[model samples]
Target: MTSIPDPVEGPGASPAVPGAPPPQLVRSPLSDGEWHRLHPLTPLLRGGLFLIVVIGIVFANLRDRLVFIFLPWLAPDIEDEVGEWEGAGGDPIDFIIANNLYVLAGLAVLAALIVLVAVFYTSWRFHTFRITDDDVEVRSGILFRTQRRAPLDRVQGVNLTRPMIARLLGMAKLEVVGAGADANVKLEYLSTANAEAVRADILRLASGRRLSAAGPAGALAPPRAGRVATLSQTVGREITGLIEGPEAPVTELESVVHIPVGRLVASHILSMSTLGLLFAIVAIVIGVSQGVTWLLFGFVPAIIGFGAYWVRSIVRSLRYAIAPTPDGVRITFGLFTTITEIVPPGRVHAVEVTQPIMWRPAGWWTVRINRLTGRSAADGSTDQFTTALPVGTAADVERVLRLLQPGLPDDERALVVQEGMFGPGETDTFTNTPRRAWWIRPLSYRRNGFRLTPDALLMRRGIVWRKLVILPLARLQSIGLYQGPLDRASRVTNVRAHVVAGPVSPFLAAVDRDSALALFDGVARGSVRAAFTDRTHRWAQEETSAPEPADLVRGAESAPAGASESAASGTGEDRT
Candidate 1:
């Protein structure tokens, strides 16, 4: 691949315009106690949160806004307090009693409003995410300061979210995704313009070069924009593989799944605060007399969330396209606001075909990756990568998997899925079965369960949501050759496979241990052999492979007496 331009070394580069001394670095707002001017999109995007809270506050103080307007009407009813009695035309004692409380309440409201404005100002000035030549930096907080600097090498990709407000303003929020010390550190929420700049800068740094935008103070990148043609290409690619030839099959991909907006809205209404609901009910009663019914206003947020969700569902998933390119996998979609994410194929750790219960009949599956860097705020603090595939078909899944893990099984990219909804006796690459009284019934109705025996280990999950886990020798984290007291009579043993958070069998449940050692050695070797230097790609493609004897199930030895703790990471998400 040709090298990126050397902004520092290019001869034509604006030769330090032979003027005064080269400009020096300016102080950051954090140091100088000045607010850093942020992306213009910042206010509009975050304004949603404030607006939510503010509306509540304003409603809570409804009587206050209505005060002056109603004061004229209320004043005369107040025992002729201020105007008549306060002028000594009425009883002095009654006058004081009537007006004093009102005067004090008004004074109190003015104080509160002033305090509210100060808070809003400070909050707006605190959080910031900037792209630097070397890394992405987040400087946030006011009293107790927090600054995060994540190396560009640690950056996974810029996750762009166009919230309702961002859509209105043509802005985007950028997440600087990297594995934080505990999980992944993400510099969240940048303006659209700055978001693009930061994304480009990160990409530029990922390329192992300092961009001209880098100065003592990192320069803000105008949002790195993908061309409309580029987006169309990405769209086509998301449909097909870009980097890989268009021969791979799509596995667990869903092309068409109708979003139930009404259901979503109803669910939200059902989930609202009891107090809010009661208020709406009260407003309905008041509407019998008052022309202005507050009940109507109560539905605004639900409507907004409803619209936002539907729009997100439609636009985000609309004509969604995925393709393999020379650099990595590119995904494109959106009706009103377009977003395209390019993921370098090699950075992908693992790929999975996730079929949630709701998406089952619709044949929708979400394809997600455990990538190198970045996490969403939702999935704890670490990098959690996901591409919710509206289309979940085996063919789509295979195509995506190839892009994520190219050459995983080079023989053939597509594998026919064997039907075994009732039990675990299906394998595309190897014969899988649940013999030896191995399966644990998750729910009596569904055949999904955990299974472990000396011969082969598998976690059979799914009836409504089906998942079959077949852990062969190569995938075992460490074989637990143990049998519980009750299991002693059954003469069965279990093995646990430890896979890290990134790709490759992350957090799989139990599996038996026949022919596991071979599988373990093979996968471990595969990991070592697959490690590459280039670490980047554009498009991904298709291939189909059938089960081979090499996909063996290795039996495990009993667990060491105290090896239980070591198995925690590989155990089920249900801690109980």
Candidate 2:
């Protein structure tokens, strides 16, 4: 291969030298290697209890048989006595109860101790993890020997989960959520402080900060020690600056917003899941009264568990706040194992602001984003990193909008973005579902709407849970139009924007059929324009100024297709 001379480094050169071949990265070995073993208690904490329980159960079932067969031989004293019993009663259980009971108990205890020590020791010896500047790697398994690695840049998020026992012991498990599905790296049972420090390092590295593995025993240095000061120091410096006005230190990051604990608690209590809990309670009562009292045992435990989970989840999200950092947005929250994650700029793919019907009265909205990251949140409904704002006011929504896409024209927000989130009726800048749609979606028809802006296609829907999905034209992967039999009868079509896979693909339903066709054509054309004009996803990262979307149609080009007349005709109005 003809090797070209190294090109002068420019805007986006590879970190490694271009002309020279990249250095090969190798995994640390198993024994006498740089790889670090998990906390000594990890095996016991993870599986030792279960093994003990299993062994106890087996011992309980086989005690009499074991005593009958081995007791006489192992204990010569029992041999003479059991030989006498062979004449009195040949029953194994009788022998176990009379002569060999203590012996059996002793044997069981000894066997359990042996198995527990053997299993836990082996497990502890096998699991190992290594942190290099470029990647986090974990090697596990006794027989199969599985090794998994996640590159520092590809790590989307890191979760430090401390289970009930783990928390009590002040230990935690670190899960590095990666961009690729196969790149999950988990380091279980690190000291709580160590886990937190490791998580910070991962995020710091992912945010493009350099980390030196030349520290003690090849461990990455504490992220805050020298690279970045600890949170307390940062805050203290800010306070010190404010007091010494003349010598106020320059602040690198600004705290933009913080969610109140009271609001978080209330919003979680009134969440859509509250309705589900009520229904569950009602079902339990009805079922029990109807001679299905047996169901109470299962249903009650499940209901309690679900409620507890939600409560913890709510508490975890409490004290949620967003701040601007050099790398991107800094998200910090959590009741116990507080998390601090840096979402690098330009990574967000889609955005959704929604409010449940009950919550609308309270002026609360939840903001979530779709990023090019790992799987959806724990519930599997949305991306794990989706919820930027679990609950907030209109102003909060605006703040988030400004942060995500600052380049959007100012007129666009006033003309559509704000109103599209919680507006009523159609305007020159917005289009709503036809009146005929009310017959099919009686409660939500008035709220279903779409607005086209220079940069994004915004869709709003729902009465109980209001939703605004913002899909940037440049990020669109495909556009689709669908009409079922009922939609055809109602003379409406659904327009779906297929974006990158995560949570926030935008879909607008019950739009007038004629308008839908026109909207689809406009979006397809807009995407082509956006591809050339806007190359960067992050507004701040744009190198070249592309032409702004100058003449985006505010609404669909065509009007509703005789929607009122069709409703009056009542041919298929009540089909739904």
Candidate 3:
């Protein structure tokens, strides 16, 4: 219940020394460990429109009855003539009108409005959220109350979403993504400015940074206009954003990658979904020509569904852009309902770069990652959530990869793009599937391979639909080597790196048996070492002069003597 500071008169209000930089004012009011209500118009914004629609539908259905009830004097002459018709079919409302109980009916309507207002007011009052150093908590409901909390350490990422309606009202929602499924906590309908400030405060707290005290003397704070002026400014900004685009919450670094509309449209047109739709349409055409009319019913529904999905996909990627920030990667997407997701360092478990055969001509690739989204499959579109780069050229992919994996050295970045993405089996760096194993993977034998770096494991596969998966050692949960009868006969093995559940699959198929064994040993030992030395979880607190990539690679290669023994006895099962 603490009052927010008056921006013009609070700390940092006076002018500082002539040459000194302006002091940074504390912008967040909700981070003071007090339970705070959401936006004042949250109730109306959340369901007011729905309530109006429901009332409109009811009035439409009972238009005549309502007219008679409210204005009985006007319809008095017609009622007597239709009394017989009404007696047989009319309900309690008609009886009320017939008895001239207009006051009673009006009272009933008034009562309903009162109840609705009370409910909405109480709901808004009860629904409160609190932000502390440890976690973000939200409490709601009157009868079946529920409380949800997201711990700072377990926070996977933070998403700020502005739906079309909410954006019009200059409001945004904050979803604090936790480490496990369905663990996300949402603060719906906060003022846009406050939402941005709260997001920064939460991320700062999660990053192990303490809030600064009020500014020193002569440090002038930014001026603030009156509430009326502020409201006008917010409205203006929202209107401007509709024509332009939503502004980013944080200061983005240079070199941001933006996908072109033409490329996005073309990529989807040549996608597997489009191809499947084409085949379905051909089948439908053939069926129609063969005098099968019943197929049209099914085909129409399928077409509608496919069209809807395709359009949604394109709309979501309309304003797609990705850039780096001090926290991690900032990804913005969507045309109407803009979502800005901040994925901090060390959250990404696995990264995959894939190229469909059709996209190969354009040298375009799609990048996705495996990370804890704190949402179930049924909650939302997990595909869109996991996709980092929807459709971009090879250069765009490289730039996005750098943002996603900031620790990756220049040499490793080249290895990822050159060897993992486009290189053939002739490279010495990658341990490829042996020629004897060609029968099992005839099409991709020359392209299938795996490479190791100090920070991650890279698995490249497929010729028609090329894929490269990168799994960071620190995030790896377990490693496994599989060899079935066919694999053994082909003198090859399959390796899988287990991580969080997501879109990226880390399984590599058809690797030379000896190379697979060596990979298993190295990964097991290196993962253990990486886990021990990993400091990315609290990156802000880590030492500035970290080891170079080459030194780390060398250290991984010449791991301690105990590392090998531990890895040999570890749970990396090599099943035959």
Candidate 4:
């Protein structure tokens, strides 16, 4: 481990370059520049690559050098013992350490030079930054110092990182992302005050775009300075707001939601699986007392393992929020070291809403978005954040879906409601004795819907939680779609509903074979073209196909009693 270097003191310490307000100092145990130091694994990454390259180069040049050293040792080895080769080679160690000196010295110098260049570049070119009212400026560069600027509108997201060193340094590196930012924008390094000040000012300056929570109770933001008394306009107002009013900034924090204290602890620590810190701690204590230091170390981290896990759980389980902005969506999580992510809505190509076996009863949902460019955790990367709500309920999902693609069909509100019983809703809904079905496989067919006809059977079954994946003919990616052998033998044919999932982003859903072929022909032959076009086609300006018929019963399923406001109110009660 390297020793701590002295601070930049004495003569050449540059003055605080004028820019945004200096970062406010917070009471924290880490040191300046502690955040940017490479992760312990960093050197390994570079060193591993270097080792390969260096070895290849050394081996390439080894023959000539080997001959030079071996000439002297050849006589001794040949006389003393049966040499492997015809020559008497010199003392292996002596020869190796001798002539290898030049090669070693050259390597050392090259490495030292590379290190010097990198450090110089880092010191001179590196800088942290913030956007100010007048301009978005940066202080960066190593040997050749620089301070550059652009307009605030040109600025995009501000990424804050605390490299392992930065964590220890008590300071953070800030990068102001923009359309065309410099490669190395680490402007001001190792300055805790500068970081916070820069971050706050940038936030305040662009305060116009701060994210807010959804719903009536969410943001208590005051009206803008000029628009306070414009209340009864007799219509609706679509004014855009960036930063919310003063009251709910903490709501900007995603970890503010209240999880039942008991469940939060249990889910993260002491559930039946017992894989959380409780198990680790219990195991650690037992191992340590038994004088099994190696074993204890094997399971848990020495100084900070348990704390990290606890902190991670708190960050995930608390106040969760997903907001839609004009440009993109910003998702923030964590408490001590908060993470704020910004993803543009335009780039979003697909979305996945999943409920795992355990989460089914919890009424929790997790969503993941497929962006054309940004990295996703689902595929595999450090960036696994959801573009929309990653965790929430049916209502939350609805709100986010609406936000994701505004102006979606209002009539589909009922479709969304119908899906409540249909999807992974609250646990009590499924307590009516799980149904068992027998078909190709026991678990494959969970339930049977009343046969609309003998030739067709509606089967609903899943290994874990049951799902009703519907398939309709009109949305097939391939009209000539066919069924496989397994499906045909069961007298059941699997047909795809849509090649995609979602109103905005569609995916394939498999259904029985008879339904598949029938639907395919119906759609392919354009038999249901007129009706299908009218209902599913959002872009068409075609009029309603037929006149509306009066409801025979007042509270019929076709027309329910209360409005959406009432439904929302009932769901809102338990959300908090």
Better of 1 and 2 by lDDT: 2
Q: lDDT: which is higher, 1 or 4?
A: 1
- Give the per-residue lDDT of model 3 (tens digit) for 1-576: 333321121222123323211223224656656567888789987778778999999899776665665687877765664566467755776677568777898899989888988898788877888776678988888777788999888788999999988887789999999988889999998988778877876776677543253232221223677878877787888878977888644577443787788888899999888889899899899999999988888888989999998899999988888887766788889999999889989999999999999998889999999999998878676677799999888889889988898878998998788888988636558877888888888898878888888678999988898999999887888777888999988878888888888888898889988888778777776676676567666656645577664565456558664454254322243445
How much is the lDDT of residue 317 in candidate 1?
Answer: 51
Where model 2 places Cα greater than 4 Å from the true spot, the runs are 1-34, 48-97, 101-111, 131-134, 163-171, 191-257, 271-306, 337-341, 372-385, 403-417, 425-428, 434-443, 485-491, 500-505, 513-518, 525-576
Query: What's model 2's TM-score?
Result: 0.64
TM-score of each: 0.54, 0.64, 0.84, 0.41
Candidate of highest TM-score:
3
RMSD of each: 12.9, 11.7, 6.1, 18.0
> What local distance difference test score does each model get?
0.43, 0.63, 0.78, 0.39
Leading candidate by lDDT: 3
Clashing pairs in 2: 357-464, 369-386, 377-384
After the best TM-score superposition of candidate 2, give how far the Cα of residue 275 lies from its true spot, in angstroms. Answer: 4.5
Q: What is the per-residue lDDT of model 2 for residues 1-576, given as tens digits with 9 covering 90 to 100?
A: 233222121212133532211112111121111356777678778887787788799789766445757574555455565456556887665566567486786798789788878877877777776565567877666666677888766666666555545554556787787776445687888865567556655554455432232123223324336423443454454344333311111123444666787888888788668889888899989999999987799779989898898888786685566766544666655555455455665566678888887787789888888775554435352333567888888888787777776657777866544577767745545688999887877887887888777678888887777788888776666667788999999999888776666656587788998887777666655555555555332323324454443332212123243332132111111112
Candidates 1 and 3 compared by lDDT, better number: 3
Q: Ranking by lDDT, best first? A: 3, 2, 1, 4
**Number of backbone-clashing residue pairs for each candidate, in the order shown:** 106, 3, 4, 57
